[model samples]
Target chain A: MKRYNEKDTVEMRQVYADTLLELATLDPKVVVLEADLSSAITTTKIKNQLKDRYVNVGIMEAEMIGAAAGLAVAGFKPFIHTFANFATRRVYDQVFLSLAYAKLDAVILGSDAGVTAEHNGGTHMPFEDLSLMRIIPEVTVYEASDATMLAALLKQGYKQPGLTYIRTIRKQAITLYDTSELFETGSKTLRKGTDAAILASGIMVAEALAAAEELAAQDIDVSVVDMYQIKPIDEDAVMEAAETGAIVTAENHNVIGGLGSAVAEVLAEKKPTKMYRIGIREKFGQVGTADWLKQDYGLTKIDIVKAVKHLCSE
Target chain B: MAVHQVKDLSLFAQEIRYYTLKQFVTMGFGHYGGSLSVVETLAVLYGKHLNSTPENKTDPERDYFVLSKGHAGPALYATLFLRGFIAKEWLQTLNQNNTRLPSHPDRNLTPGVDMTTGSLGQGISAATGIALGNRLARRDNWTYVIVGDGELNEGQVWEAVQMASHNKLDHLMVFVDDNKMQLDGPTKDISEPHDYVEKFKSFGCYSKRVDGKSTEAIDQAIEWGKKNKGKPTVIVLDTIKGQGVHVIEAMSNNHHLRPDEETTKKIMRECEALGERIGVST
Candidate 1:
């Protein structure tokens, strides 16, 4: 097991800014587009560093996506960032036709997923963003586990073609891995054990890991995998995990059409793994801090521990 | 400076009508009412003005034509076929199951299509983006977009208007096909805003009202739009729905009513005679 360090204690938003800034420097064609919330989203830092490449289209989400499509047509790679709720819902038409349907290469960074925007209330919390974006045929969806994963994912997003939605969070998350480890797009098994397999993504990966550690003390060895890329899921890894008979799914999004559903889609077809979902139930979140929201939604280390126990009992 | 002789404009209008009828009949029937309304403007834009090629479809530096009122794709599709951007055979498969020419003009599926637009008011916003992009890149290629007068009901259309005016995107030219009809009923019955010309002028656009059927006026509008460099231009084309076919024009719901067999024959007869008059084949 790898020991986590304080060096990985960077905020995902700050990592997102740093990664985009580095990407802009590395590829002259890379451009950043913000929807008036650049400073709030912390992408203004990247804009400040890469002045010529960053574009701040004030408060016009639809127009920003449209302009990004045009920029993509003109041989420039554009990265658009805004709140997760607005990115998928408000400007869906523009993102659908202008980017996805047109097959234009653009990246939309959606921050604050699943009650991450605590005091901002339900309107700000993007509980169903994953479902909205995953419906688009060509979209590649990613939810980062930590700062390092976000940095790596943003780098990968810059190099990738077609539409990809990065479901970014606004808080500093615990580091799950070091930079030396390789991260695949679809599925990557982080822990290998015999009792059952734990499939988790985004902020839930850390909880899943902690739960795995607790379950191991009880003589139940559990496997942990980071299912980062939701669409075009790693079918092979899922099948391998299901071969062990016990399986559990988790994410920072709603249970429906998110990571759990994505895994279930493959498992139902290939191997029937006894699965349990650990996520926000079919309910909207209320105003609260990030820690309180996570606890209220059963998205904690204790929740994961209980879920693993239930799967074992079944 | 190029003047389109009325005879040539009449011929182009007949050709556009012919293709539109063919596409409508092939697809069983689509937004024929809206499609029929924009025939004159589509004729002028694709026939006499826009610089494009059927072969070099992906050329980055070429001028762009976006159909913001994309429900009227049949008119645009007919124009594309006439311009040789797509093979004439492709028209037969329009709106068919798994056809390249779906109800909307998908840029990925169709050649010479600048953007895929079906949702009203989005096409102009995309064209605004293209103009802004061209300006930023310092490219000479201008962008042109056509909107149904009824499509102005969408608020995004005005958002595009403000952006175009504020950015001073002179390379952009917009033609509002003021045929005065939409999905439900007439634009006046549904939600008639203000005088679009004055609305655009107040929004900072260089505005004009033109007899859309006259190719000479359309060409002049194009030249004026090109010569003016600080503000965007909107040419309000006062056209009639089903203008070439008199019977269809007389119908209350010209938007999507299929002409009877006799009416179809009459349209065919009119196109055939017009073709002969212009010395062109259908």
Candidate 2:
């Protein structure tokens, strides 16, 4: 249950592997299916420990998803893993049909979310996975902001039915919460304030929290909420944030149809909140380090803080 | 009760045709083309093969049937009704509001429906999954999935095909209703994956092509599929669109056409004649 240290920077994938290994021991129905990226996602430990429960289905992502569905049908809780790009973009039809369309109790672990696959560049970086998955009728999309929730999401994922997409960033990330943090399938409101609210997800949650701290220094109080769960997004938390005057949405994902779009949709329907979105503008990421890509996409804490001020001023 | 003779198999196909026609008449409109083409295959499975109970519909040990080309739900529903898995009166409520029998077969909603499917190229994957699951569970149940020749155009179908072959899902049998025609004329005109036999064989599957309308041929293919040890079977059914209904048989647009009153009367007459021709009483 202890996902990350209080101030440690650990990849979400480590938590995923730990949770997967734990599930293999506790739940007989738990199975892991990967598409030739077991080594990349750091699930080798899980594969070694739970060999019978894990299946390396070659580089066939679509087949891997189908096999996962098969495992689910056989009364096994199957967690499928691949890069975010391969998991979502390559096998969209499989995810849509074999998993979500059939309403199978399957979890798809999409690692290296957004521009996190930095050196791999545009081909591997999935900018619109959340957007594509959230529109499905029965899919629950979760992107872990840090290691703390990755383990929690994996545990919660097996208990929940239907198709679940867990977007995990593989690189070391700034840990936001202690291991005792109560994380669920829906969004978790991390910080609370009244002057203005900053909604964020994935790695941007750390930036949002840092931005909140900086804003407090400037005498501008800002609330930060971690909208980790994209679909079945914490509507109450979003509505409450809108009630706090201004809202600024930030994410490492694309500006369109990602966390920002999901929150904007909720706000557009309810009380219209004056909000600005801080994410990748309709563009592909270039080859660089994960940190460089995050900065190049204007997903740093400074960007979040600037967006918070702009939305509050407007 | 033992190995069904050719006459009995032919009669069973007629029964399938009769029930399918009746269901379509009840639904007003349905995918008549694909359903009619797969009637013999369904008849052979239900009549000569599949160890299922109409009474104990949820018997976990029973063989499973998944219609990959799920637009043909009317056909499967009709077959299930005739098998006594569902009440005949329920067939009349097809596609109605709050009807369990929607345009597609929903297992959660309907009795004897193994999987919920309507999206093309998906049911096969579920069926493949079911077969794999059964194997994992050490269950003796075999899964049969029917895919349309046109539906094979979907890349996901190939994905399932590859997985099925790779897993050596010998208990799984996939039947392709190679009726040649799709919603847009012919399958070749749309997307051509020529030589499904060779394609499946190359993919490490035991592949065979049989006259889908011939009940005896379909039964033999099913038997062969069942006997195959290390590979799954892909039985390509060479069938005709609008097979049993004469009026629809003549019209190319029968894929979505609902029989008018006059045509319905003619359909009844033709169905009766066809029933007699196949040596079966409706």
Candidate 3:
């Protein structure tokens, strides 16, 4: 097995633009909307390529969401793009009422997810987008772990036929899946073991795999899964992981209601296994690189390793 | 193909207002003032300008209506009920338990309701979305949205205003229910930025001012708006808090009212007297 450093990565933003252009090519109804950040993946590229598919709704995020819903009503598969901060918290009501409650076909792309906001600091970081989007009934909330997952989710989002929120990181994503593989909305297990199961989403999937590999070197067995879809969480996979009787959930979000809460919701009723969450412990993010932010917030592979070990011991 | 005559539209306006009051009375209290203010506008749009019928509820090319001032749902429900999109039986069920009609318009629950809008300032943006979608599809569809003057205070409304104009949603017509009143009191007291006509124009909209109480004026303004090309039109409908009913219009606060027996009877008396004088033979 080979360990990945910074070099083995692709920009999720460029992958997003290409995936969106592919979707637009496949279905002319696929349209993208951005709030002044036309340079972001789905906005400028789609505008340049499709001619009439990209809409720059200026800096108005709520209008971007509502207009996306309106586009949904008019038979266009609309994808709205903005930072996760404005995408979830600022325009939440529009997403809730105009998109979800109305049953519209729209994809909300909240980029620069979680601690990846980096130099943009706490105001730009969105650790609670998953929580807010999941509360809306039947909305498909997903976090793309790498370029491959980002590309897959972008295609699925175009034809989801309901409100979907896709959280993406703009910068580095350590490569996880081959470009040839196809994906749908569910969890995927990359590694298996008998001792403990590690559930992770978004950036934490890579971290979980790293933690599992480290544990394997010490003769400790642990499984890693990419819980990509958070709303309709893969319950069967969670149950399978629970058979190990110890679980560790990791994500780049608040431990209170992010992927931790989602996994807890499943295990609390179905399996009731010993669980630990490796994520930001109720703390807002600050300016730092993804690596520094991971260490600062205790979301590194080391943290996942510690949590899984603790769960196994208990 | 004779046009739906002016007297017929005027009569429909009276019917909309009457049913609006009846529903409010049944619900014991509701947002009646704004509902009353937009009846004539609704009558004109639904009766004359719209290409929708009960037989063609899902007609893709038909004009769409969005109630941005969604507390005025009773008026719209009345118009839709009278227009046969809803059964007359659901007329009295306006905010009752398990009723088909909710306080705000929901496209999922109600037929002929183009967009679900309760949260204010969002429906206008939905209309912009619909207009933009139609533009992208190169389809001949129109969206008529009614927004409150008070709703314009919300910054989100301005965002849609900017975007709709920037995209040149020429088929989107917005009616600013300039009812001068909000929940607290006069809009001037709550948020004092008037002259919506100038505001929409400055936002690059084809803007005009119309007397909202008059069906003919609103109808004519809509006609003029369709002819003015390359921009969305905003009809800043100059209206009192309550129109057509002297008693309601005279109330110190009618935005949402809990009319005591005396006030309710007085409203009924005034409404009937005015209806009779105007030959609205109810």
Supply the TM-score of chain A against the true chain A for every candidate structure. 0.95, 0.94, 0.96
lDDT of 3 by residue, A68-184 (tens): 888887878987888998999988898999999999888888998888998999999898999999888988989998888888888888766788889989876888887786776
Q: Which ten residues in a row have the lowest lDDT in candidate 2 chain B?
A: B1-10
DockQ of 3: 0.84
> Which stretches of model 2 miss by more than 4 angstroms?
A1-10, B1-7, B54-56, B189-193, B259-262, B274-282
TM-score of the A chain in candidate 2? 0.94
Per-prediction share of native contacts kept: 0.43, 0.43, 0.78
Steric clash pairs (candidate 3): none
- What lDDT tens digits, residue by residue, belong to model 3 across residues B81-180? 8788999789889889999899999999999988999999999999999999888888877888999988988888999989989988999999999988
Greater TM-score among 1 and 3 belongs to 3
Worst 10 residues of 3 chain B by lDDT: B1-10
Q: State which docking tier applies to candidate 3.
A: high
**Model 2, residue pairs in steric clash:** none
Question: Candidate 1 — which residues are off by over 4 angstroms?
Answer: A5-7, B1-7, B26-28, B280-282
TM-score of chain B of each: 0.91, 0.92, 0.94
Best by TM-score: 3
At residue A220, candidate 1 shows an lDDT of 87
Q: Report the lDDT tens digits of candidate 2 across residue range A1-314.
A: 12222444566777788888888789777888877888887788777777556777677777787767666666778888898888888888878877776668988888888877878888898888898898888788998877778888887888888988889888677777778988853776667788899988887887788888888889888788888898888898888898878999988888898888998999898889888999989798678887788788898888888887887777
Order of all candidates by DockQ, from best down to worst? 3, 1, 2
List of clashing residue pairs for candidate 1: B33-B255
- Give each prediction's DockQ, rounded to 2 decimals: 0.56, 0.45, 0.84
